[model samples]
Target: NQIHSPFWCPTTIETPTKKSEFPVPPCSTPFNHVNSSALSYEAQEVRRCLRQGLIESPEMSHAESLVLAELEDKLRAAVGTRYPQDD
Candidate 1:
């Protein structure tokens, strides 16, 4: 009969407990979150407010996104699509 060493068992393996050695650097520039409510048509934020809904075509969806973003900014709320109006 042969006896095995105790070091080879699963209990001997050390699990990593430390955080990433090279952590991702924080964004140097803060996200440019625009105040949609204060914007007018002239201050069109056509890319800031888009939720980017699922569309049949990527191009179509992108165009709709741009339009919706502009509308949301100008109107200060969701301006298109049949949403429940605040009654």
Candidate 2:
């Protein structure tokens, strides 16, 4: 007969009873609320550009292409993929 102590067992680990909490400081940047119904095309384009990542190739789907086309001309120029052939 063989017996293994709890300290020597690999699966008998004990966890802490209470977890520590992190206190996050409030954001330093002030927030300016804009009306959703008053968003202009250019504002929308800028929002879209900021949210999307750079596409490296033209192998994207038709839906993706449409979304890309919706981006502002300056944004497209920055991405350097104005058209499918540009990839």
Candidate 3:
């Protein structure tokens, strides 16, 4: 009922936390942009696995071998083209 209502409600406000600041430092050494050796190593390892898969495909069903072959080809192409060579 309107006769039983309270006159005022208490409220609380939270204080803001201090933020840590960072300043941009001048560039010293040129940052190394690419790691060609690592990329090539990984690609070669994947290629090796794909070759092994091809060899073992004879034990798999015809449809499975076909799918594996298609995937291997796509991955091979991607690895070959995606990385840059060290000049």
Candidate 4:
């Protein structure tokens, strides 16, 4: 009888011998591009704000807060789809 595992597995078992044995299709979507661009822009803005002294004034603090919040929301939305909702 063969032992089954939900975690570790023996490497001696059946394994693909050729790279082509398992083909992976290219995954590209317009949403991915847009999301990447938005994330990049937000990161740049955050860095710029930090370099200019984010806490120099109340206005700067507010602006930086907004940028950070937007970045956080975008990241959560992007990852939330891959995870189940909490109760």
Cα lDDT listed for each candidate: 0.40, 0.45, 0.46, 0.48
Q: Compose the digit string of candidate 2's lDDT tens values, residues 8-79.
A: 222233335543332223444553532222334435555665567633323445677777666655586887
Q: After superposition, how far is residue 63 of candidate 1 from its true place, in Å?
A: 0.6
Encode model 1's per-residue lDDT on 26-53: one tens digit a residue: 4445434322223232133334334444
| Candidate 2 error regions (>4 Å) | 1-39, 54-87
TM-score sort, best first? 4, 3, 1, 2
TM-score against truth, every candidate: 0.21, 0.17, 0.25, 0.27
Q: What TM-score, to 2 decimals, does candidate 3 have?
A: 0.25
**Which one wins by TM-score: 1 or 2?**
1
The residue pairs found clashing in candidate 2 are: none
Q: Tell me the alpha-carbon RMSD of every candidate.
A: 20.5, 21.6, 23.6, 18.3
Once fitted onto the true fold, the runs of candidate 1 whose alpha carbons sit more than 4 angstroms away are 1-60, 77-87
**Clash totals for all candidate models:** 0, 0, 0, 0
Comparing 3 with 4 on TM-score, the higher-scoring candidate is 4
Residue 47 of model 2, lDDT score: 60
Per lDDT, the best of the predicted structures is 4
* Alpha-carbon lDDT of model 3: 0.46
Rank by lDDT, descending? 4, 3, 2, 1
